[model samples]
Target: MAEADAFIFAALQQSGMLEASFQGSSWSVSALTSDAFIAIVFQFLTQLQTSDDNVTFTLPSTLTNTPVGVAARHRVGSKLANILKELGYAGDCGYNHFLYPSEKETRNILSCFLSPQAAEAEDDKFAIIQPQSFLANTLPDVPLSLESVSPGIAGGDVTSGDIIMESVGSSGVATKNVAGEENFMQTQLSEETEEQALEQVQKQVDDTEHRIAAMRKVLDRERGELQQVEQHVLETQTTGQEMQKQLARQKQLITMLPQAQANIAKLESIFQKNAEKKAEIAQQMESARDPLLKEYAQLESQKSNRKARCRQLIREMKTFRSDMLELTGVIHSKMESVRALERIHERQLAKLDKKKDCQDEGPMTRNMYTARIMDIIKQVHKQKQDITKILDDIKGLQKQMNVASEKLKRTEAVAEDKLYTAASKSKTSNSGKSEAYVECYRKFAQVRELFEELIVLVGDVGKKENIARDLQNWISQLEARDSSSHLDKVLADLESVRHENGTLQNELRACSA
Candidate 1:
């Protein structure tokens, strides 16, 4: 019996419902009174029954003369009745005696605890029990009873003094029993302890309610934050879709880059060929200009020399004509003088003939007259010869002057023809050179334009290559992150972009054509 009490006490202590103390070769629990202990046991049994209907825990069969044991059993019966009522089991649950009945009396006692209606209900419906309610019921108050005194002992015959002693002793014994029972049911019997316990229980209940309310508030706040996060995710998805479209267009441009590069290379080759032809033509023009310039310089020098020589010849001819005129004037004057002399001599001769006929003079006078006359005749003849010679010389000089003037005119005409031919040849060569230079300039302009276009295209190609490199690095990073499935989708997108680029290229070719 002591072992059984000790086991129950230990179990209560372990559950934190009782505090044990050593007292004179025995252990006492002060945290729970007998009634509260019984209530705790009943609650534990109720939980066990609800948890598993097939299992049952039997209480110990020990009985004691102490009021605590009896009060405990009565408290258990009351708790069982309350449980049955809460479970909706109708009908009365019988007396406390059935709580620890003997094995032989178990069947009969079980019927006393469970009414027919309760037994029937127990098979189908089970009640949910709350932990707060269990805690409240586990320590219920129990009233002490003094009605179990034996009537036969009270009626026993005795003397006056003996009766007085017996009365004193009985009063003392009752006081002792009450004090012992008070210790076992402290929280229920004492007003101050019961109030303190109630206050403590109320405080615990209040604290639990506050904690639960705080948890609920936290949960609501978290729910609102989660909703906001969901909205942000939706917006992000929309922006990502727009970015994907832009990327698709960029990919298409990248796909056409190689073909554009090939076309640029072909154009550059043609430009190179044109440049080579221009250079060759320029060299040929330079080579051809050398001899033509030399010949032109020589012709210019010859023309200047001829002009100077013709001018000098003209001055010399004019001087000679002036000299000849002066000489002819002197000759004419001399002839006039000679003519006078001849006339004088003829008159004289006439006079002499007349004298000779008139008188025959002496031989000496006749010879003197004849001699003077002959001398005069000779002088007149010489003067005539001199005048004729002078006239002849003047005629010869005039003829020479005419010949020289004619030669000068012919030389000037020939020189003018040579100059004209040289000028015509120089003009033809200049025209050819100008045509070649014009053609070269046109070709150079075309080549310069092509080069500028190529530079632009190359810049565009470089930009595309940089984009492609960035994309490759991005794909590599995704692969490193173990997103190969997404890589496959990206590759498919690339192929589609390439196809679109090919179509665009075809359209461009048609437009250019």
Candidate 2:
């Protein structure tokens, strides 16, 4: 739009009906004959006011500085004023003329010349310059001050029929080349700054990419290591659990060993007591008389009954053999079952590790992995339950074995007690003490034989019982007593004859008395 205005003003300047020039490089003017000029200037000013015409003319901010835009402004404004006047009103065009392009001058002229109130101020009649545009007829009492221009310039007091043209001149030479070079330099600096900024941005991008790659590698390494660690942990856990179970079983056996040793010790002590009692009874039998011998025969019969009880212990030992075999087999099965559970636990732990590895890889839906872990957890729980059940079974079998063993032990103990009781009595009794001691020793020998049978019957594979061998010397004593008892029987028969002779003598004595 500014360009179009430039063209129009250029055309008007070229039209030779008016002369145009700039004054002091700030104000501009044009002039023509007054007859047609004043009416045309009035019409143009009114049109400019009504149209609200505006032009932005670039100039150096300081009035003394010359710019191309200022030259163009002067030329265009001068041409516009000249064109206005040639089309006719009441004035020529110049800076101080009534028809000049001063906005204040034009407005005041319209107020004074076209107002009816101005006719009332007969003194203001001289300010009437022309019949003009429609807005000129609606003039108010307001006045335009021309003080900022040269005094008395373009005022309501003016009546202009003659054309006037005046100008203030400038002689400084204009230069466009220097300004063009400065603009080019600024553009180059802007382009260089832009290139530097782009390079910096690219460098930042490269650094960011390298950091991202490093982070990704670190994450991948950690993830792989974590997976391996998880697997190792699971394997270790499985091995640890198996070891713990084996240790527990070993501990249980260790606990039983001492008790077994205690039982062996107790049985040995009883055997020794029996042997000592048998020896004492032998001494007692040596000094006894014929009446005591008859009493000793009765004691001998009781010792025979004790010998039969020892034989019964042997029979009971035979019956326990099958039960012991079953117990050993059950123990083996339980161990196997425990081992199988351990294997399953290991497998489940392995699967859980795989699931965890998969989960760590990326934004995977852990649902399947989690579900698998849960399944493995449940399996582990079930394995724990199975292990517990197996342990319970082991406990039950152990209890059964202990009960059977205790029964055999108690039976053996009873037989031992009987032998010892008979032997102790033989030591205290004078009558038939030798016969009774021999018989009691025989019973102890039988009982020891039965215990030996029990050891063989219930023997664990690859195991031996140094059978309670303290009773061995006692057996020798019993054999010796058998021979002694035979001698004692003959002695008693001899003594009985002697006693018969004595009894007859006693009867004669009693009669004599």
Candidate 3:
């Protein structure tokens, strides 16, 4: 169990979840009781895109021992537990898995989460934070260091560049002094230490400046609106002031109203007269249009008839064109067939002409043919006699050649036996002998011993047969043993490879963060 705690602690440290100044022995003794754990959870939630905006950054009991503190801890724990389970964490996963887990359980959980695949996933998830870090790092230098940070915030701190969010106690409870004007380090500036107060001050200044500029523009816009409203009011008053003058003009218009009415009456009379004239003219125009209307109807009918005739002609032309295309195709095929048949006919005629030429009147008669047949028959009989005589001579020569070959073989065997008989040479080889001759002599010596032994074995058939059988049995045993040993060697190699692979895996696990 202690080993497991050590392992987990080492892993946490390697993953940069703890500050460099932390020197506690056990996680529960130092990290778990401080704001560090909550900070870590906050980081995890942010990486996962979870809502951790309400997570308090103080220790559980630092706020209060009341139900409020308990509930806050529970909320944070449950959120982290859900994320862990979604990451495929098994076992009794709950709020307690993070806050009340055993050392062994913690080890198991971290082991699963720190796998190579999970590392890659974490890398991608954390990639979105790189730009902020870059900006923070490139910020102007500030006079800050770890020495300036409070002891509580410095203990087990992971990073210097991070957002500044401090949870405060508003009620009767008192939150821990984890961050303050000069105690905390944040990502708004790359420093060994920073304070949340500085970030708030800068943000407040920026917001005030922005608000001031916007308010100024709003003021200008309001001024313009005020001026327009004032001009509209003046125009309204001027029009109101001219109401009496408008009344006098109205009285004058009242006097002229009678004259205008008379004119209106007169125009009405003229309008009535013109209306009657218009009606008469309309009657005249309508009567004139009747004949034109009839003629237009007749023309339209003629146009429709022509259109129908054209449609019929187009259809007939289409049908005739299709027929022509089909007829052309048939003619082309017939022509091709005829040309082929003509070629065949020409070939047949040529063959017949050749036959007639060959059968033309012969130069010799039947008696000439008979004489030729007798001559061929006599010649064939003479050739038969000559062939039989040549065969007899060939047989005699073959028998003589066979006898001579047998005699030569016997003499050569006697000479070879004598030449290769076992004997010893002088201690020193003859200096006059060439290298090839010396090599030949050495071979002759080995061959002589083998030949004598062969002769003896041939004379003793049983001994020769026993030697051959022993040799075959020995070869079979050697083959069987070789196969077994080869298989054993392959198995040994495989076992060695497996051992090496296991060792390499263990080393990799030990080395990885």
Candidate 4:
């Protein structure tokens, strides 16, 4: 029975499926059971098969005939089917009593346990199985122990001591197999974990490099901006220096402003003094003009009075000339009467001579003739006395008219000379005064012309002795012209008569003195 047990254990270990199931649990002796172990081994192998193939396991004939062995096999097969289903294998139990729908392989399972070293040497043969696909089923193959193999089964001589030594050796080999399998699993897990850690470190390195590059670009951009700011600061410094120079120039101008203002004040003072001087001169001129104006008015009044006196004297002279003409006519008639009286006296004398020749006649006739002659002589003497008185009265009136005309002429000449001198003085003094002064000068010139005309006419009157006859001729000429044309002639004749009367009066005054 021990031999049988040894054979079964060796057979289970030799199968690739059983080795993987044992390695999955790290070869823990407590988890291993006869039925569960058989199920895991069969399920693993069945999953390795292709869909169109079938996997077969032939049991010992003695075990298959027993009820307990048959029941155990059935239960193990059911468990195997359940494991195969969990591993994603598709198949059903067949009438030939083997798992169906599996892949085909020619390798013997017993060789994996018999020569574990040989299996390692052929590791390339199963290298296609990925760690993630069969990790739960994978395990290291362990060499079978010599003690676990009965000599009778192997056909070799054996003894009690050999058995004891072999047993010890077998136990040590199993311990070594469990430790080797654990070490192999740890090596795979460590390799996978190292690869993942390397990948994470590489990813971190890439991210850090990218971040550094971005920071460098930002630094370059900020450096460029800082350079521009520095240039602006340099330009501002230059502008500030120029502004300081301008401020100095402006300060110099500010220093001169007070002197300029003082000069302006001095000029303003001079202008004000000049204006005051102009006002003073105007006032003095106005004061000097007042007396000249008064004198001019007085002279004008005197000229008007002189003109009126001259007109009145002309009228008186015209009346005196008419009276002188009437006196001359009466004197001529008186002279004719005196001549007729003398002729009558001569006739009477002749008659008296004839009467003396008859003297011898009577004495009474002689006395009557003497008395008549005496009466006629007395009447003739009275007539002569009356004629002499009339002649003396005519001579006295002519002398008085001549004296009045001479006085009037002399006064007119003095008034005219005074007016001419006044006009000349006003023309010189008031030349720039006003328009009225110019008008006064023109009036003075007209008066001068009238004075000249009167002087000529009065000189002619003085040369004429028959003043009445000359006046009569002038009147006759005036009457011959029209009234309108004779107005100027009449005025001229009146002015001549006035001048003649003025000359006569002046002469009379000279003689009387």
- In model 3, which runs have C-alpha deviations exceeding 4 angstroms? 1-268, 280-284, 287-295, 325-329, 332-336, 342-513
lDDT of 1: 0.58
The window of 10 residues in a row where model 4 has the poorest summed lDDT is: 101-110
lDDT, residue 190, candidate 4: 100
- Model 2 bad stretches (over 4 Å): 1-307, 348-363, 422-513
Using all chains and alpha carbons, the TM-scores for the candidates as numbered come to 0.23, 0.24, 0.22, 0.24
- Write one digit per residue (lDDT tens) for candidate 4, span 1-513: 344334435545554445454544244323445444444444445434532255343223333222245565665556544644454444443211222212121012222223443455479667877754453354222123444766685575665446545776899999999999999999999999999999999999999999999999999999999999999999999999999999999997787688998867977999999999999999999999999999999998987787566556545544544554455455445544544554454456545534543452332232344454565566557556755665576567557656655764565555556545555666677765435545654664575466558657745654563475568557756764656743664466556666666998999999999
lDDT of candidate 2 over 343-427, digit per residue (tens): 5666667676666655554432335445756877887688779878888888988898889888877876786676677667767
Q: To one decimal, what is the Cα RMSD in angstroms of model 2 from the true structure?
A: 51.6
lDDT-wise, the better of 1 and 4 is 1
Which regions of candidate 4 are displaced past 4 Å? 1-271, 340-513
**Model 3, range 140-170, lDDT digits (tens) per residue?**
3421543577767756564444322121133
Which pairs of residues collide in model 3? Answer: 19-156, 19-157, 161-187, 162-187, 184-194
